[model samples]
Target: MSFLKKIQQPKFLPNFLKVAIPFFVLVTIFSLAINSWSDIFAGDFAKVAEANFNNGKWKAFFGYKIVFSAIYGLYITNKNMK
Candidate 1:
């Protein structure tokens, strides 16, 4: 059917959303579960985050996502090329 064919087409936003939305949900759940918002308001989490930022943990944290996106993009590009 046309609907099935349409659904089968490779769409980046849907694929990324499948991963990203769930990731965001999980992070939110984890944050709430750990009650880390209290630490945020108390200034403890900010201090830790600041220390991590100064020490380059922010790079490590965000860099992995960048690397992953690059790799995934490459994979998609190669697949499309083929």
Candidate 2:
């Protein structure tokens, strides 16, 4: 079989990647919407985000992502097992 054909099969993807990818994408979209709303009604909080990254404060967000992803993964696992 060709590499492309093999990769097209869902069996190759681990369960966690499948669940985490969609969850991450959804969280990203929601975050962007919140940022846009914050920008329109208040001021540009994008600058604050950038400054946080510059100051290494964004590390906390990465931690949040990992924790949330784990929670989502557990929820999915529990649902699938039932």
Counting clashing residue pairs in each candidate, in order, gives 0, 0
Model 1 clashing residue pairs (backbone):
none
Residue clash pairs of candidate 2? none
Tens-place lDDT per residue, model 1, 1-82, is 3434443657744655555555545654464435455666677866656644557766765565556655555445344431
Give the whole-model CA lDDT for all candidates, comma-separated.
0.54, 0.61
Candidate 2 lDDT (Cα, 0 to 1): 0.61
TM-score of 1: 0.37
Error of 1 at 50 (Å): 2.3
Off by over 4 Å in 1: 1-8, 21-25, 28-38, 65-82
Using lDDT, give the best candidate's number: 2
lDDT of 1 at 5: 49
The parts of candidate 2 lying over 4 Å away from their true place are 1-13, 36-52
TM-score, model 2 to reference: 0.55
